[model samples]
Target: MYYGWNIVGVGMVFQAISFGFTIYIFTFWAEAWMTEFNVGRTQITATFMIFNVAMGLVSPIAGRILDAFSIRVLIISGATCLTVGFLLISFANAMWQIITVYATLISVGSVLAGPLAAQTLAAKWFSARRGLAIGWGSTGTSIGGLLMPPFAIYLLLNLGWRQAHQVIAFLIVLIIVPLVWKIIRNTPQEKGVEPEAPARFEPTQESGGQAVQWTTIKVLRSRNFWIPIIAFLPALAAFSTVQANLSLITADIGISQQKTALLMSIIAGSMIVGKLFFGGMADRWDQRLLYWIAASIMGFGILLLMSQPNYTLMVFISVLLGLAAGGFLPLLGAIVGGRFGPEAFGQVFGLLGPFLTLSAFAPMLGGWLRDTTGSYDSIFQIILVALIPAMVSMAFMKRQAPATQASG
Candidate 1:
């Protein structure tokens, strides 16, 4: 067993905690916040926009730091911010305080500790099995999604939302800080092992050599960079819209809170299968084809949602949605890693962050549309239409090529 697997395990745990406690469990908390603050759904959803925008704004800097500095130090700093931010949120007396904490510490911390860091680490450690490695590591988010919402609801029911935040903070301190310090290494060379590829180890301009460091301007100008960003944006926007509003959507349709949580877990459970399946296949299949499949499934799921199906039908829809959602992260990681090489992985991924902030608005839009139309149907229809361009643009995404070397 290679030491890189250990790094993957740590990343899995990191994503589970970061995404589970914050993104997956947020809607549950949103319900409580609405009652406590006397605010509307759109206002609560704005926290997600602020959090996402903050993460996007900080990602490029974080990416450069990851490439040039120590990942262990960066992760530890992020853990500190995440723990402290959650602790502060427990004491927030006003909506502005929650917004401020989310926009600053929480958002910044998530970028440092979340998928960007985890996928970069995986990309660095494995060459041949990059997709599988990323898929396995990214499963932590689905696992977190599967488990966190129910646990959060239990805590929300028993301890109140404030105490729940405190518990989440404690878990972060107990789990992420020590594991990252003890287990994570920057690359395979640091652990005295070769990357999982043929043993030739000969340096080349294309294979296992010093990768060309892409400048920010060059990365932005490349069609390779922009194509994936454009291809995946709508799917991501739709997923974010659904996750952020799942609770309210269920309530609007008169589903019980318990069942709603179960639905969320079902979506997450299905995602685990999707991630493993799509991830393992990415190494062998055309990545663009896999993405189109996932996008199509997602579109069909959204179409089902517009029909206002019964609970049984909704369960079926959740499975479709989960499978599609599950495929996105691993594919994105694999695509970026494949195209850019590990040396430029962090920087390229970081530069791509702000564009993802666009997805954050999907939730706000969902909330506004629901509030204005008194139905979620319009948002679902809009998301379904959004998928058309995503799939079509994906057709134009060229296959991966050797990373271009930077000029002196």
Candidate 2:
């Protein structure tokens, strides 16, 4: 078997630990923080905003480091930061300490070890199979989501939140640090293997024969760079809004806490299916069409939420949202790789990081809308309207040429 598959496997594990701890298990931790700190919902939401903003600010630097440095070094450093940050969080006595840690260490760690790194690794190792490779790797996030919450809840119940953080920190040391150190290589060439697609040795005008190095100014000036970002922003924002507020949203509709937890698992489970299915399709299908399909599903899902459906109907709605959310990361990675090419993949992806800060506001906005209007209906409506321009922008995006296709 090719070592690239090993890279993908390690990437999957990296995503599982990074996203499981940072994203999936966040709401559970937030609940504990609220009780421990005696804070309001909005205050809890602010920490999440801080986490994202910090990640956004650091992403470009992380991306450049991924491009220029060893993947092993970056990932191991991130794991150490996460282990230390979580351990510190367990000892935090005030909300300020939690905010500071989240904004600094956790935020930086997540960028280095999370989706951006995993996707960039896949991009480096596979060209023709980039979508499928990324699809498989990105599944770590959904898998983490499916497994971590129940485990964390159990820890939070039996041991206490502090001990739970300690256990998670220990697991990172045992798992992520060793796996990345042993298996990850900066590129396929490092393993004495060729990438899945034909290697480009001749310089093109766009990229000078070496790895395409995109300057910040060049990336910012390109319309191709911004099109996918604009097209997917709304869907990402909606997913963030739902993930951050799902607990509160379900409680408002009279769903039990247990059922809300199950809904999160359902979303995660369905995301696995979405990532694999849409990921395979991206290599064969028009990516813009896939975006349209995802956007439509997202719109319908939000409409279902507006109705405040019962738990039974909410299960179905969760599948719709999960499938759409699942497709977002892999598709975006494939699109970025397709447009920018593997040579410049890291810088381009990193450059795109700041745009993520826009989605960071979705959670805060959702919370504010709920507090002001006494319901989440207005936010759902706003998200639905936001999808219109995304879909339209996707329509205008130029299709990838045969040579530049991910399959190529």
Candidate 3:
């Protein structure tokens, strides 16, 4: 296999391993923790809040660190912390113990090993195929989403939740941790290799050897940056609200838990296809047009989700939403990378993550609305209304043509 492809493959594995423990498997533990620990849903969700905090806060710092330090150290350290955190969680008997293990330790570990590292690494390695490489590497999320839920459910059935964590920890330590420590490297320069390829757009350096750097402040000040936020915010609300309530929504319309789970699997499986196919297609498409199309598909998916919530409808909506969910991440990254260049990517994108993460609160808020209003219809309508602004805003995010540089 080509070295670049190898890197992407390993990166995908690492992401799967990391996210499996952090998210997909955690849902399996939700019932166990509440049953055993006598905790509430809010308490269980608090762990996810801690995760968001750590990930959002660490992103900018991790970006700079990737520039300054070797990726091997970051990857290994992250894997170790995540694995150890899960193992420690297996021994948890108290609320504080769960909080420490799930919220604090795993939270910290996930930040170091997440999308920022994988995307940044891919950014450094590939120039011409940057979008495709980044997309492939980042597909770890979809893979983890597909595999971990069923695997977790199986482990929960057979060995119990705690034991599942222990097993997952062991696998991570034995496989991903060691492989990363041995194989993952920082850059071609660090490996004593000459640059064998050039980018489509090379840096315009000054006489004093400074490449033009786009500061986080400068990027934030640009209209292009904020315009996309409008699309992202409502899209976040729509997608997350549906995901959080999908099983419930289906069950309300009389589907059994078994069939609901199967439908969820259908969504996850479709994501694998969406991630690979759409990710590759992104590199060749007009990014602005692509964003609009993706957003439109997402909106359509939400509309479908709101329709019947029957078995057939559930399958169709799941496939549609799965395509949206799988495609959004890499496409968003490409929009940034193509517009801003890799040098400024970390800071610009880092700043954007918190707003997106805030979408988690949308589901929580939607739940509150459901309780007070006694129906999910209003919330779904609100989400649909929000998409209009998102579409309009996305249309405004095109890159400005650069001004000519004069000779000194």
In the range 210-249, model 2's lDDT, one tens digit per residue, is 4445687877887878987888888899998998888889
Best by TM-score: 2
Residue-level lDDT of model 3, residues 15-61, one tens digit each, is 88788667666667788899999999888877766666667666666
Ranking by TM-score: 2, 1, 3
Q: Lowest summed-lDDT stretch of 10 residues in model 3? A: 198-207
Measured by TM-score, how close is model 3 to the native structure? 0.91
The regions of model 3 sitting more than 4 angstroms off are: 193-196, 199-210, 400-408
Better of 1 and 2 by TM-score: 2
**TM-score: model 1 vs. ground truth:** 0.92
Of 1 and 3, the candidate ahead on TM-score is 1
lDDT, ranked from best to worst? 1, 2, 3
State the weakest 10-residue window (summed lDDT) of model 2.
199-208
Off by over 4 Å in 1: 35-38, 198-211, 402-408
lDDT of 1 by residue, 156-228 (tens): 9999999999999999989998899999889988877877772112112455545455788878877779888
